[model samples]
Target: MVIRSRRLSKDNTYYALKQKIIDSELEPNQAVNEENLAALLGVSRTPLREAIQRLENEDFLVRQPNGRLRVASVTIKEVEEVFLIRSMLEGYIARSAAKHATDKDILHLTTMMERIKHSFQLGDKQDFVSYGFEFHDYLSEISELRTFEKVLNQLRDHSLRYCRYVSMHGDWNTQADEEHNYILQMIADKNEDGAEKAMRDHILSSLSTALARIKGMEENEIDHIGP
Candidate 1:
């Protein structure tokens, strides 16, 4: 494949590679072949190596003792850790949203949630997952706090790996829609405590659901291994 590296400076390359990891194109636990990725990105090995190193430092990639780079797996334990932190950060943001969200912002959020709801009803799993993620992101935007925004983005980036593999095929999207809408209403009404609880519960609920799914898959894998 011809890789186009145009318009990519150092910062862009690093983030692009980072996003690719999140997108699962460069899937979890997969090796990172520097020479090939450099060719693929149409850049020299130097910039690619730099990006890889950055990803490594960020815990997004792991350099094996043999000097091979691998995508970091999102383990069940890691998922719990990430969401625990995210719940706290976003719980505060939701409280802030309740205190600060304007009618216009709530209206926009309602519209976006409805659009995602429609996509879910239409059985567009990819769209459902995408919208689910974007919905939380929009809520962070509602907080109007730059620090929260940055931290939230990092949290989102960490969770996004599982998102690519996350099945949006269930009725979960509808549940998510209901949850987000409730959160939005609380924020609009400036019910700070309600908003915080709703958002925190939502995060915990989803994480539980995801963990269950991962556990089920693991069980299936073990069953297969036995045969």
Candidate 2:
């Protein structure tokens, strides 16, 4: 369980824990005991503590009043805050990408958008969701803004669990695909203003739809982990 970290990337332990948290391999609301996790990851407590602190700063995990770390969870408020921030950042990224993206980048995004649609046709929710994640990164890369990409990457892993839950139970992939088409066209046309508005609308609409679905599922209890 050696955690071999390369010098090229950011903190290795933080990312490892982040991925595990995002993948749901580490359960939500589950307590992380430092000594155990340190042993498990084959790292000393110092680096593990450093990693946990980073996650704590990011709001991915929180220290309870009782003084232990757990995957952070809150009511619908978290959904609102995260989605609002997402709308802003996504709108900016889309607009910037329209201004900066190359033809090749647009083509790549188009290909990914098509892949998302095809994935839905195949009823592969996992794939549709995963490709959606990639599409976002592609857009961020094209925006030529490392800050936005960094912010997005931080939000995305946590968002994946929520998106997966929504896609699995929400039954609105087709609508999502339609929204993707709108965004793609806006970017392709290099309409920065239009792309920004469209992206903001899409983010709000998606959030609304997901919340509605979650509300409908109130009869049956489900854990909604939001970014």
Best model per TM-score? 1
Candidate 1's C-alpha runs over 4 A off are: 1-7, 168-173
RMSD, candidate 1, Å: 3.6
What lDDT score belongs to each candidate, Candidate 1 first? 0.79, 0.79
lDDT tens digits by residue: candidate 2, 1-227: 24444321237677787777765557667788898777767777777787888889977788999998887653366666677888999999999999998888888888898899999888887788899878877888889888988887777766776676666675664678888889999999999999999999988987897788667665465445433
Per-residue error at 202 for model 1, in Å? 0.5
Query: What's the residue-level lDDT of 74 in candidate 1?
Result: 65
- lDDT (Cα) of model 2: 0.79
Worst 10 residues of 1 by lDDT: 1-10
Alpha-carbon RMSD, each predicted model: 3.6, 4.7
What lDDT score goes with residue 93 in model 2?
95
lDDT of 1 at 58: 87
